[model samples]
Every structure is written in C-alpha cells, then in structure tokens.
Target: MKVVETIKAVRNEVIAAKQTGFSIGFVPTMGYLHEGHVSLIEAARKDHDFVVLSIFVNPLQFGPNEDLDRYPRDFQRDEKIAQKAGVDVIFYPSVHEMYPTNMPMSIHVTSGVDVLCGSSRPGHFDGVATVVMKLLQIVQPNEAYFGQKDAQQLAIIMNMVEAFNVPVNIHGCPTVREEDGLAKSSRNVYLTNEDRAEAPFLYEALKEGANLILSGETRRSVILAELENRLGTGSGRIDYVDVLRYPSLEQSEQLSGKVILAVAYFYKNARLIDNYIVDIQEGEK
Candidate 1:
C-alpha cells in the first residue's frame, strides 16, 4: 500500500529488499486498474515476498495519433485496488521521471515486431521494449507478470529478456475476460453501449477458429476466412485476424504443436486486441 512516485525512492526500497533477501515481483501497467490488471498483481503477490506495480501510462508505447492524452487514468482509485491485491509498492512515476529530456536511446526487439500489432502500429514495440527495459533496470525484480491478452507484446518482452540476458523471469498469465467473453482492456471504457454488446464476438470468433483447427482443419486460408466471417458481425472495424506459431509468431499452414489465434479491431475510438493459444494434438488425422 506504499506509493512512491520517484524512481530513486522505489529503486532504493527495492535495493533494500534485495539486501534483506526478499524476492521482488513486478507488474508493469499503463494505469486504468481492472480485474485483468489486478489479477496480474495477485499472481505476482503469490510467488514473491514483495510485489511492485508500476502505473505510469507510457507515452513511448503510444503513436502520435493514438489516444495517449485521453488514455484512462485514476491513480487514487488504482492505489486502492493495488492495496487490496496485496501489492507492496505502487511505482507511479511521471513522464519526465521515466524519460528525461534528451533521452536518446531506445530498445528494440526484431523477432516478433514485424507483423500483427507491430505491423499496424509502427514503432509501437520499440516504445514498449524501451520502457520495459528501463523499468526492469529500475526495479530489478526476480520476475515480471504480463497478460496473454497482449500475446505479441508478451512474446516481444520474452525475446528481449533472452536476447539481452536480463536476469528476470517473464511470466505470461491467461487473459481475463468478461462473462460474455470480451477480453478485459482499459480501453473498454471507450466503447458505446452497442459496441460493448457486440465486442465479445472478437473472442467468440477466435474461439471458433481454434475449435475449427481442433476439429481437423489445417488450411490457414479457410480458418482465417471463417474467423473474418464471424468477426464481421461485430460493430467494430476489423483490423486483422491471424493464426501463427506460439512464441515465434510466424504464419503457419498446419496446426502442428502450439498455435495462436489473434485478432484486433476498432470499436468507437478504441482499438483492442485478443488471442487464444491451443495445442494441436498429433495424429488427429
């Protein structure tokens, strides 16, 4: 329940925790606390002696035309939620604290940033990797938690960890969804009443595509066509629907081992993304 806004203060506390032999678990978020975000904090709390949650709305991850200024934030409310989730420290830093004037350097991961969300939003992953690397350096946690709702982002972070040899364990948790199946997102607040009702179809369509693959369909074209058909019924503008390998995220023609069905669409002024992972059993034919 302790809230620290300065990076030096948070870093000092983390250093003290390490000296005391306490393991730290970190959850980095662009603040608009939801069940999905709280779920990440709770998971971190379970495995580590101390849990730190960062609530800075990263400007780097947002494009110039994107909703960075209007992105939802309520730190007072977020603090309460974090405390309830057993969070030990809430690292709420200002933009200047995270990125000083003339911050020239940035981190980039080349493996999974060329397609899907990355393809649509140029320079998005660079911002993500940069901020994440900075946060990891500041907190120096033993582990970090991210939701599978952002499958590609998770993959990119994991790739960065491996390639850079950062000594932190990156854990991808399951996507938390509403009862009707819409993947919970902070931007869900931007949807209209009608848009909210129709939004769940994104997840439904992904589930259907996964089921089709499980039912012995291997043709990527046919599966993607079916997914598009289902998502087309929703009110949002469909961005993309793709099926690819698990961590590699390359397009796949056959359902062999681990496959992911991912989609992104725009509802109202908000763009949302979701994905599902399925294990394709061998010898099903």
Candidate 2:
C-alpha cells in the first residue's frame, strides 16, 4: 500500500482515482491497529474499487487531561497491518499537516452532545465531528466506514453529515468483539489482568439489557436500573448506563424503533465503553 504523509499527496492520488472512474472507500482511525480496525478495512475492500485508510491521532479530538500524549502509537506495525488488510493507500499525516492553524470553526450537535461519554468528556464529540469533517473533505471518498462500537459517536457523525448535506455516504459496521465478549478496543491494552477479567461484564450487562427488552419489559428506566445492577458489581466505577433511541440519542418511553443500550466504566486507569443496539418490535404498545 502507498503511504503518504501530506494532504496534497493523498488528495492528488484520490483525484487521479476519481478521474479514472474508481469509487473510493475511506476508513479514518487513530493509529493502534487492532482486529476491529482490520475488519472495517476488509469490508471496504470488498465493496469499493479503491480503499484509503488514515492513521491520525487527532489531537483536536482529545481533551486537555486525556490520554492524548500517552495514547499508543506504532506506525511500523500499523503499516504492515494495513497492507495486509488490502488498503490501497494509507494517509499517515502528522497533526501539523492536517491542522496547519488553530481550529477556527468547530462542529457540534445540540441534541446528542450531553449524554453518555459526552456527559463526562465534554467537547469530545465536537472534536470528533470537526476532524471527521476535515478528513471527509480531504479524502473526498464516495463512502466512509465507521464501527458501531462508538454508537453515539457514529450517530453524531451521521447527524452532522445529514445536517450539513455532505456528499459522502456513511456506513456503520457491526461492533467486533473478543472471544470472551469484550468489545475490541485499542485501549484494551491498558487493562490489567484483573481488570481484563472483569471487563467482559460490560458486554454481558448489555446482553442482559437486550434480553430484558425482548422478554416484554418495555420501560427504559426499568431496563436501565437492571443494567446498572448488573454493571455495579464494583468491578469498575460506572460512568454511565443509558438506553437511548438509536442514531438520535434521545430518550423515549416506548421501546420501538432502533434503540441502543450503552455503558462506560473506568477500569485500571483505562476508560472502557461497550454497547448493544436492538431494533425493537413495533406492535408492542
């Protein structure tokens, strides 16, 4: 795979590909390649004529005291992984190359910006939307792939694209998990052995929430209480446990339509998040 660090270099190649009538598929990521990331690249490879994967640990998306500096980086390893995953080009740009000046304008959505991770980490989604907007503009891909693991972030980006009328199509892929049911994350490496053992409960709790919803329990508060009971095993301090309407991130009484059961917890100095999305049956009212 061709790896270029400059935006101009990447843009020239993308323009060339477009001129040749090739549809571009883009997967934007913060480097620390895992099987979850590879899964997205594989999906893009299957669908698009040309696939571009970007590895930029966007500083704008990180909070002031967050793990921006200590967040992992291994470009050599990531390069090998991307090439093996069939990426046609890797946009490995430095932070300065991508952000030459201070971010004058930021992207924010009023509705979904105050819950889940947004509650704790304020301005997180704003950074996410801004960088994603910049990347979409730079890559100019026909389709972009994002994992559903960050269900809220995915929803916010979808809303941003729709609100701004960006031309690129966004595809949300399924969450990839480990054999033990822990949703795969680059931050999983920070887990201690004990913390790792207790981590799968996040997924388990989400599954239990789904089961409760399926078994005719329609009240969101009831399911949320049960979810908190399951996650409050003292394994890690609970950050938030929410069941919001999917994509919109709004609260609802009836459980019909797309709904997401989500949890975020702090375990062993690493913050972990997991969620399960369920499409509730319509005639349950």
Can you list the residue pairs that collide in candidate 2? none
Cα TM-score of candidate 2? 0.97
Instruction: Estimate every model's Cα lDDT from 0 to 1.
Output: 0.89, 0.90
The residue pairs in collision within model 1 are none
Model 2 Cα displacement at 90 (Å)? 0.6
Clashes per candidate (backbone, < 3 Å): 0, 0
Candidate with maximal lDDT: 2
Off by over 4 Å in 1: 282-285
Q: Which digits, one per residue and each the tens of the lDDT, describe model 2 over residues 106-193?
A: 8865879898999898889889999999999999999999999998889988998899999999988988999999999999999999
lDDT of 1 at 256: 69
TM-score of each: 0.96, 0.97
Task: Report the C-alpha lDDT of model 1 over 37-57, residue by residue, as the tens digit.
Answer: 989998999999999999988
Candidate that would win on TM-score: 2
Query: What RMSD does model 2 have?
Result: 1.9
Query: Global CA lDDT of candidate 2, please?
Result: 0.90
Query: In angstroms, what RMSD does candidate 1 have relative to the true structure?
Result: 2.0
